[model samples]
Target: MKANKAAVLTVAEKCKNILASNWQCHLSTIKADAKGSKGEIYTSKVKYIVKRGKPYVWVPESDAHNVNAIIDERGSLAITTPFPGPLAHLLKSVQKLPSRIALTGDVVLLKEKKAQLATEKLEALILSEQKAVNELSYTVRGVLSSTNPVFTSRSENLQGLTDGGENYNIYKFDLRSCTYLSGTGGTHEIDLGELQTSKADSLAPYSAMLIDGINQSESRRRALVLFCFTYLNARVKDAYILSLDRKGTDVLGKVPNPTSNEQFQWKEFRFTFKEEAPDVEALCCQLVEMEEEAIKKVSSYSGLG
Candidate 1:
């Protein structure tokens, strides 16, 4: 139940960042009165959106979890960070495991004005984020755009917000407690107040873009090696950017054995920014400055400065 008060993002902020980046969760709930299944707990994968410190999901009225919500309002959601495909090579390392979070709370169906407003907000947010349908190919996008019952019926049900029509209903999962498991095997209990007030990392949504771009560019990729050599004094090869946040970035590299130079070992290095960046533009500027410093140090050491 200890908290990592010194970490860049408190346990709560990391939780919010992971939740906002991912749009789906494993939802679990108790079963309503139905024959022998009456007190059983059921788990299902569902799409959700975090709005104003709350997670909301749209489900069919007849869905088992929805029915369960009517009788027992207790529920929980589990979310895990997805490891990017580019980093698949590091999968064997235990230190590179994905971070996970579990939240327990009350599951209540929305009503009246709240339902109406949540519907509008949910649709707008989902469409804006596009995480739900971001993988749609051109053909699939075209099919969904056409006049079809599959598309039309879903739109109709979505419009019937307050009453939920005959098909769908909206439910809000109110957060009561949270547990966060870090990538390094540490666990912490998040404070509800911190969870309520913390904002998701500003660069989270675009972090993948940044990492991909750096890995693709030769000069940028070499900059990582140069920085490690200059600051950490470690000669490395096959280095790549691992993760990025507002405060700093993590890089993983293969270090060669000094004696044999035949065996290679993997090591992780962190570079903290001179100051916290408010946006990507500032972040890039800080990195460029660091690269310049690294180059100067390397040149001076080689007596070429």
Candidate 2:
């Protein structure tokens, strides 16, 4: 029989180890100042390196000045330490002592509380980044689908129908350096550099048109569904995000049945500046052709009626 394998250490432990051996925690302290303005007094030397799964703060109790300063700042004994070096040397040291060894007063409690809060925050950041990515995936799927159904939740497969007007500002590019990434600012690692969303202060109204292409042979109301696709660009028309549009339609194609071949014939419309005439002209021409075909379909339906 094969031998049993050891259970892996939890994600928190892994993250802790990563944080301990590498990331430096910056602790700020407010102190009374002579100039009447509040001054922050911090230590450059009180840094700690992660040593063998343990936080090794170098501001030892042996140093009277550092020790007193730590005590004075927190009103309890707390030493500040940033990650210094590797941890292999302190493996035996960690196993022998309690998880933490505090020589000072209420410092241990504060440190422990901080550690707990940090862990919870890290988990929250993970959730936030996951949410952003999940939303992005849905947006991509919306662009690819034959009909874009406005979904209620970011993850739910359910779709909803909406008038084309309310859909413009739904999918937005939030342009701010919100600090919850990596282990710091917001943890969304979407580093879309250089091509950031425009900060232009212009009053241009976005247009939306819903076209239910005429083919009334199918008896079901949901059977005939037309999807709207919007190509978005922050800088110029040539540049495109993978999915820069909201799922603005609620037409889920036939399911399970192999024979249902419902095709969506779309009438495209676009807006562009007159200065960029060449690209704008091409887009307009395409729209005209698409509109002509849509008109022909409408005329045929009129003739049948």
Candidate 3:
């Protein structure tokens, strides 16, 4: 586990969440010449699904990368989380980079039964996200539908992706080594076993909705900024939850320049939960408690009854 324990997730867990959250990845393979000596590397953007912590992708049988991968099973995948849905506003800062992972692995073609399973997993992933988005608040749904390309571009074309059947070849990426780049935590090398044993954050699917709701609510936003000011000792001009997991919340704060009030800079801060929340209900309760604690601390600091 290369990730710091104080952080919300381990490097491996973050890798799992990132893989589960996004469908598109850059697939890199080596094309060998007639003598199979030095080869040319080719990278192609392709849709993918993560099943059991392994990435699976499908491409037309004749695709150059596919053909290259067939000749040499060694390949790699670079995946990054898509633009966050309605909460994009919170992550607009340059400090708020995307979570990404680069995986070096053996890309082996899946046969009959394995291919069927991989295909089904891809279909299920698309359907599950659609259903989950549908259950979100109307505002989040509307914003996601219009502004988020991840959903807007793929939702309608999902059927076409899997319908290619015989024309597409399914391949599973067997992880050899992984490197995780945390948006704020820097980069770390993750072991294969560590990644294979870890699970995606339980709150991953609902993170956008939860963060967006807090950002949209005046009281919640006020409480969050106040918490940063009072507890974290941050001179915050404004603050919002950048991301959330069962382990904690990452807050992005805008602070006015010490020399010039008109100028501001962005900084990221982490607040780990006392205990991991098991579900949305528990997470909400923890957030409420945090808000209450912040309010109380603010009142005490100001000597107000």
Candidate 4:
């Protein structure tokens, strides 16, 4: 093996595969299928990486981020796995390499199947978790789809620190009408379900974080359950709310918790729900209103209007 046959073969096959099937590597050359009506195309610099003893090559950059997703989304393909070379050695051994390796149709098909399977698995996990969280909180809160929630300007493609587009707008509803009892209160306050309660039932497997406020003997006392996504992003996951009884409860975990007095002190978390996007001043004003709403909900069950 002049140059480590195993590694070289692996890399060669990968480069060949990239040259064969992937859309990113479909180069425009003097060869056939290289010309459109005008006959010119942009060049792409696609590369491969070798880690440990294995070599892997797929799409690069943004395309790579969603490469598998693209393949799996197509229903006709009915993919069950991802492309083979990118897989670990165990899976690599199981693959039945294509009869015509140059064309790379078999590898492409495998990639498609892998993507499809991964997509299905992710979807199933999310749905199952959602159902569990939803059912658990049905009696205490409401979770609404964040697709186009309220008046927040949504841009799915934009990546920013303040952007919430990638995340669905989660809203919590506590029909009790008391602001504090409705989680953060205010229209902007979405339900995280019942994240706090006696830990006796065992919510450890739920994927989201739990809140355990101190209490004499209520088992779980108070809690502010959050969705899985929120649980993972907390720099300081802390939440605080005051019940209508004026019992002050604060949750200190990942994100900042809402604050309120125990009795007659709950204002709502205000949100700007408008037909058009709010200006900076308007957004601030809306948040003010949201806080007021939260206050009202927490302070008086009858003052929701």
Candidate 5:
């Protein structure tokens, strides 16, 4: 595997290992634009349990709304916890290293249950694998500089060292260092330096047009799905455009029921435009027409009209 690919996979496996041992994690759902600007972050506490060696997350019913919004909006999830002793020692050994890193993951919202029922059942069957549950696979990236001070301050407070009980530290991660990836298997290392200077329109003409069109639309997510269905001819779930360049647009989402097991896995779809869209309005019109055609095709196939 390539270096980037290896890095991503390592992060995913290590995260699973950590969760399996600790069983408790902090989950944060974030909504941000392709440009990495202007977004909201919501956090919830959740339990991670290992079943049949696979990790499954259990969220309280009260937190379901936040989690579902993440899936519907094609937002990102940041799963974090204070570094365990072993992990913290490893990180501390590296000089000039980031205080924190954020990993990108795919979140599948499992069936919901009442808080009391979930708690009781989980307590009883803690060692067994449940039939259906929420889960994610994540790729990580370092969040430099800005994170260190806050983590340091939180650590001092947590250990009661500011008042000098002992010279102890327990770092805490904040949501600001959120790392959002495509969620599809492919991994791309985001150069934070470049993000500071690059404009959204720096992408290819068609790529730029599509992103801008959807973003400007009254219903951005709806427009994105219609465009994919019409142009790529694929039914996608939890879809989001990751990046666009002169060559094509990199999309991330799940194909509904692609496997025999009925489990959805994130996949990347790349689309190249035959001709660049002239402008945002033209792109929107094109998408609307595609949606209409899609509806007609469904109507014809189902013999409903």
Candidate 6:
């Protein structure tokens, strides 16, 4: 049977509190066939920890059997105290074996016994994968919500990047390395690599080019900035693409006031192509780099330096 949202949240809270008190929990996996007719059951003892208010189940490296099989067996997880403890009471309360509990979090397989924060583990996973801009954007949002519950509770309609009531002139950069006269009546052949500052005034034409290439609405642009930066790094206030070229891209944005939502300061970041020039993969690398930087900054800020 499908679990409702209220049931999921209630179970999550109960699991969190149980882990906080017991430091470990028994995880029973119930696997059902594709037709939802019959199933098998498996059980394991896992160390549990609460990080940023979320409960994560950790399986040690020494474990002989892999839990992935059961976890992937198209089933729900029923968590309770281990045998001989309150297991009887727990099972009696549910009135069912392999009870369905919908949990929204992660399962970590650890190589070492040392306990690490969930945020740290997530950052490590994201960095190791080197996800592209679009993938990184979603991953950053997930990390933000998982690490900071308060962020998810904030009003969704708050003013942000797209709300800035200023008209922006967009520009595009040419792929070639040569100079060409401007189309807007200006006689200047621009060498993209030689461009220095990514400041709005300095990069007017180039900025316009990057902005024009984006097909998303203004609201989406604001949401993208929040997803790609601020949400990933609490220190980041905003993010905006300044320019894009075959070799690199520049971004201009803001850093939030950790103390107040009404205050934010502007900042700029540049990403150079990691792969060969003119390849679409280069853009992917650049976007991944942005996410890596945000993760790094946030990690350091949290005293994980």
For 83-195, candidate 4 gives per-residue lDDT tens digits of 22112232234332211111111112224555444334434534554455455433222111211211111111111212322321111111211111112222222122321
Question: Can you give the lDDT of residue 163 in candidate 3?
Answer: 69
CA lDDT, every model vs. true structure: 0.70, 0.25, 0.72, 0.23, 0.38, 0.35
Which candidate achieves the best TM-score against the true structure?
3
TM-scores for every candidate against the unseen true structure? 0.72, 0.19, 0.76, 0.19, 0.28, 0.24
Q: Per-residue alpha-carbon lDDT of model 5 for 86-123, expressed as tens digits? A: 22443354221211224334454443353334334445
Model 4 ranges off by over 4 Å: 1-110, 137-305
Better of 1 and 5 by lDDT: 1
lDDT of 5: 0.38
Higher-scoring candidate on lDDT, 4 or 5:
5
The lDDT-based order of candidates, best leading, equals 3, 1, 5, 6, 2, 4
lDDT of 1: 0.70
The C-alpha stretches of model 5 lying farther than 4 A from their native spots are 1-235, 244-248, 256-260
Candidate 6 Cα outliers beyond 4 Å, as residue runs: 1-236, 255-269, 274-277
Which lDDT tens digits does candidate 2 get at residues 78-127?
22111111111222222211011111111121255554443444345335
- Root-mean-square deviation per candidate: 8.4, 24.0, 4.7, 24.5, 22.1, 25.7
Q: Against the hidden true structure, what lDDT does model 3 obtain?
A: 0.72
Give the TM-score comparing model 1 with the true structure, all chains together: 0.72
- Give the lowest summed-lDDT range of ten residues in model 5: 136-145
**For candidate 6, what is the TM-score?**
0.24
Which candidate gets the maximum lDDT versus the true structure?
A: 3
Which candidate would rank higher by TM-score, 3 or 5? 3
